[model samples]
Target: MYDFLLSDEARVLRSEVRDFVKTIPRQLLLDMDADRVQFPKEFLAEAGKRNLMGCRYPREWGGRGLDWVSTVMVMEEIGTLGYIMACTFGVGAELVCDAIIRHGTDAQKEKYVKPLLKGEIFAAECLTEPRGGSDFFGTTTTAEDKGDHYVINGQKRFIVGGEGADYFLVYAKTDPHAKAHKSLTCFIVDRSEGVIVDYIYGLMGCRGGGAARIVFKDAKVPKENIVGSLHGGYAVFNTMMIPERLGTAAMTIGAARPALEVATGYTTRRKAFGREIAKYQGVSFQVAEAAMLLDACRSMAYTTSRAVDAGVPENEIRRLVSESKKFITESCQKVVHNSMQVMGGIGYTNVFPVERIFRDVRLASIWTGTNEVMSLIIASEWYRKYMDDRASGITRDCENDAVEAFAEGEKIYE
Candidate 1:
């Protein structure tokens, strides 16, 4: 349905990504879920080989230079395979690469971006700490400058692809006395001396993507590897968030759409009192609601992507992007739940992919900054914009038009 929105290049690239996704072995997903495969390096290898890893970047850096809409389209196809699969693709293809593309020097791109997109190496961004996550600037990880190099020492909690990563884009406090926004710095730390990855086990969902805790015990990283200017991590972080939140929202939309389809298929064939279960309003209505949610979320994701591509103002983009992530992921959760509900007992079983998606979808609201955080970002930006408009007299003052316009004492504030 959305194919008409794609340019010729985008349509062709979408086909290429689909072709790559189609070749993935079913056993890979099964093994990954079962924890038989900690990480699927070969998956990225093939995607990179096909030149589909980072399609949004420039051709000079190995990407096809596709726009955000096209990337979202490709992610939708990748998402059908599974959330873990889509996330594995997004980690390097979008999230990790975004910082380099937006801030890193050409040499950094040539060294890291090319091989990563080509699937020769894999990368992960480390941010969340053992102490906290939502308060991102509260990270305890410290990088002490040693003139020739920076010695990084800290722990990152629950990193996806931790075990499989060839390198990490780590953020650590560089200026202990500086303000929160200017205290930290970003760096490209190769997996060399003093980097330890402890693969986590018994996860509720999102297994086999090499989820682990990363420890930097005085890890040696050269000064040359610093991602942006000294004490400039805040800028890098804000820049990278566009792809992180938006791509997750996009992939999640991909993940839930097929789950509803699968349940719809089951309801049509499964028997009820006397006929197909789908004939029952109880079952069909769930399907309808799920479809509506998927459509709404998809529309939001597309509009947000276009906004990002169109270079919408930073604050407005932040508001829309956060809103997209929050609304879309929550909607996806509902869609998956409704799908399972419509399918009855079987949907709860591994017999259907809905159960798996249901488990994975739980993280939709949690990771990439929880939906609560998204709400905070959204409301904050919205209020900020509204107040700016009010201050500038750009919007009509409706407060004065109230029936009790002269009753100023009635509108009391504590």
Candidate 2:
């Protein structure tokens, strides 16, 4: 059905992920939400055995050697399971393993990336701190250089997979005197004695994957464990943002889609005033609008994924990636809310999955770089492009003939 935008191989991969998701029992999902299910290590092992964990990484690293679009497809399917499960999968493969593959030495890849993909060990990215959320450069975590090793001392909160991860891709300031962006360094920190999992958050939703606050008190890491060059962590961070934002957008589609399906089916059979609710223009219109919004979100996600696969310029990718994250996640929140409205009071109860979905979708706009942050990036990049065009003496206007004919003073903004 999505053949116009996705190739046959992509469609097949989507089916494979969808099939795997079906094997996960509904009770297991409930257990996860209730915090009865601990780590889901067995589930990760199953995914690894199926070659579905890190589909986008190189073949030697235990991935399927797929493109970004394929990774999106896998995430989209896993997302249908629920936010927590999808996030667990992403933290290991997309966030942590990808970072290692891109910046780690051969030894690091052999030790961490391979096991990470095979699900023998799990990994987490410890970026956000208690003091700063979006201000990544303002990290209070410090990695002091010793003669033979670096001693990391800091706390990272809201770290997904924090409690269960065998290792962490930790970022800390190595050169305090340097500028915020240049002072930082990335490390492969094992969950050794000095590393502590402080508290597992009692979240409003998306629970049971062990999101927690992690503390590193004089955690000693070898010099060889440094990811990329010391004090060059900003480049690694920038590279990571593309996958983080784009993957969030893709997963939001999966979360919203099931809710929409349920609502659509309900409206067809659900009666109001002695007739099926679908007969009413009010409910029908809402269903149509929600469907349209989901379609638009999916299109944007796929387009951005394809752009990444094609290796588009970094700046252009940044603009589109931010736009995709901001737009898709916000649209998903709307779609799920509308779905609840269609189902009425029953939707609010645990009887329907829409209520859970409603809560889960709320976090999509807030995490992986908040939608507000995404707006800042999108507008800044747009302005930069506009100024660059002006500097180059390019007089390109809107591609509409009527708009082109309008006098400069007649245009509203002009």
Clashes of each: 0, 0
Best by TM-score: 1
Tens digit per residue, CA lDDT, model 1, 1-414: 777668999988878877887799989989999999999999989888888878889999999888999888888889988888888889887988889988999999999999999999999889889888888899899999999999999999788888899999999999989999999999999998899998889988888888889999999999999988999999999988888899999999988888999998999899977899999998899889999888888889889989989999999999999999999999999999999998878889999888999998788788889999999999899899998999999889988997788885887779
Model 2: pairs clashing at backbone N, Cα or C within 3 Å: none
For model 1, the superposed segments whose C-alpha errors exceed 4 Å read: 400-404, 407-409
Best-fitting candidate, measured by lDDT?
Answer: 1
What's the TM-score of every candidate structure?
0.97, 0.95
Tens digits of per-residue lDDT for model 2, 250-351: 888988889999999999999989999988988988999999998898889888999999999998999999999999999999999889998999999999
